[model samples]
Target: MNEITLPPVSEIDWSTWVPEQVATLMFILRNDEVLLIRKKRGLGAGKINGPGGRIEGDETPEECAIRETNEELLINPINTRFGGELFFHAEDMPRIHVHIYVATDFEGTPSETDEAIPIWFKLDQLPFDEMWDDDRIWLGHVLQGGTVEGYFTFIEERLIDQQVIFN
Candidate 1:
């Protein structure tokens, strides 16, 4: 297979970058465990990640987060709060901006759905190996209640560069 070529990270103008998709990622935290999903379809299919997707027309990021959680895991996330924002630029696709939220409570049980399967993991034992490379770099800070902003560049599925800032 031919390798895809991407512009170097330093050559991209982050200040003027526009995302083709605006998305949300909602993490449901309960005491020592956090809810994650094994995505079965769409963008990151087969990857383990938070429940989220592209935002619909006029929907606020928080609203999108709750809705996506319900749609993907059959649960309605409650007490959701903004956690951070992530900017992803991949060689083969348009840039994506993801707003992250953390929810402390939820209603209904998490169940398997067409798009994902719900799983709960300990805060300190997140399945980073089964997740995107960037998850390992910044997820810990978010779990510890630090707001973060990250910029990541990828060549297809492999991370090539990143910058993460905790607020």
Candidate 2:
């Protein structure tokens, strides 16, 4: 009889498994146009979405939003207000804990960033067809100035399912 051999189990790297804290700003133009980014890479690459990024050390969510806006869009969001918050999880990617904000006023004109390109479109004309599948589920409502919460499941960057509750 031949003996069977199996590979030994390796311990997981907790650091690499830690969930990331992300922040974003939803800049609403006077014409109900919302600021979106065409990501240069990753799951939503080439897709239209919001302007924001990860929360750096010692920075609050609001601060992160402000910083990200300047860094990613070259604009200083004014009178920015908290709109909503979302917590997304999937087995394939790092957990995303995001805070959403709405800015009706800003200091500088919007511009592109290394990671994203800033673009504007009428709210009613949002290109859902070019955005992440999950955006169509919760983003529209959020832009209407409502608070919402949801859990999204994705399989290899494709949204498989989501459960959302609006307030």
Candidate 3:
């Protein structure tokens, strides 16, 4: 098998880089359990992730977060608050900037949709192996009430480099 080669992270000028698309990721935390989803379609199809999607016309990141969660899980996030931001740079695909939110409560019950399948996991037992590589690096911080800013570089679906700052 031919080995996959990736460009050095330094080659990408992050200082002036801008994301082509803006999105959101919302997680509902109740006690020790966090709600996640098995995405059935879209960019990260087949990966386990928070419920979120691209920002629709004129909607703010927070609004998009709430809207997407309701659409994908049939629930409305309550007491939602901004948690962090993530910047992704992937080879050949548009760069993306994601706003992260955490909710302490939610209205309605989580149900499966064409877009995703809702799943809840204990805080200490997140299935990182089935999630985006960058998730494992910064998700713990968010769960612990810490805010973060993460920059990730990917070559197709492979994570090649990352940096995260907790504040």
- How do the predictions measure up, each by TM-score? 0.95, 0.82, 0.93
List, residue by residue over 28-66, the lDDT tens digit for candidate 3: 999999999999998989999999999999999999999
In model 2, which regions exceed 4 Å deviation?
Answer: 1-18
Candidate RMSDs in Å, in order, are 1.3, 7.4, 2.0
The best candidate in terms of lDDT:
3
Give the C-alpha lDDT of model 1: 0.91
- Taken over the whole model, the C-alpha lDDT of each candidate is 0.91, 0.73, 0.92
Q: List the lowest-lDDT window of 10 residues for candidate 3.
A: 1-10
lDDT of 2 at 124: 90
lDDT by residue (1-167, candidate 2, tens digit) is 54332221122232364456465556545556888888887656788888778888889888888888888788888877787776555666766877888877888888877878988898898898898788888887877878787666565667765667798
Off by over 4 Å in 1: 1-3
TM-score of 1: 0.95
RMSD of 3: 2.0
